[model samples]
Target: MKETKKKVVNIQEYKEKRKQKEVDRNELIALIKQIATLK
Candidate 1:
């Protein structure tokens, strides 16, 4: 039971990291678009 709980916690942390990376990618895309428009 304790091992399963640790696995669940690891999965949750991995999901959170993935979500943060996606957000960063979206922001980078937006910045690129803004710079393109400026040119």
Candidate 2:
């Protein structure tokens, strides 16, 4: 039972990390677009 709970927690953490990474990637893309427009 304890192992199962740990697995669930790990999965949730992984999902959160993935989501944050996606957001960071999107923000980076937007910044690049702004820089391009300025040029």
Candidate 3:
């Protein structure tokens, strides 16, 4: 039971990290598009 709880916590953390990563990637993509338009 303790192991399962730990796994759940880990999964939640991984998901949060993935979410942040996607946000960062989207911001990067937007910046690139803006720069391209400026050129």
Candidate 4:
């Protein structure tokens, strides 16, 4: 049971990290688009 709990925690942490990375990726893309439009 303890092992299962640890696995769940690890999965949740991984999911959070993945979501944060996606958000960062999207923000970078938006910034790039804005700069391109200004030119």
Q: Residue 34 deviation, candidate 1, in Å?
A: 0.5
Per-residue accuracy of model 3 over 12-35 as CA lDDT, tens digit each: 999999999999999999999999
Model 1 TM-score?
Answer: 0.90
Off by over 4 Å in 2: none
TM-score of each: 0.90, 0.97, 0.88, 0.91
Tens-digit lDDT track for model 1 on 1-39? Answer: 999999999999999999999999999999999999999
lDDT of 2 by residue, 1-39 (tens): 999999999999999999999999999999999999999
What's the true lDDT of residue 30 in model 2? 100
> In candidate 2, how many Å is residue 26 off?
0.1
Would you list the C-alpha lDDT of every candidate in the order shown?
Answer: 1.00, 1.00, 1.00, 1.00
Worst 10 residues of 4 by lDDT: 1-10
TM-score of 3: 0.88
> Which lDDT value does model 2 have at 4?
100
Candidate 3 shows a clash count of 0
Instruction: List, residue by residue over 1-39, the lDDT tens digit for candidate 4.
Output: 999999999999999999999999999999999999999
Question: In candidate 1, where is summed lDDT lowest over 10 consecutive residues?
Answer: 1-10
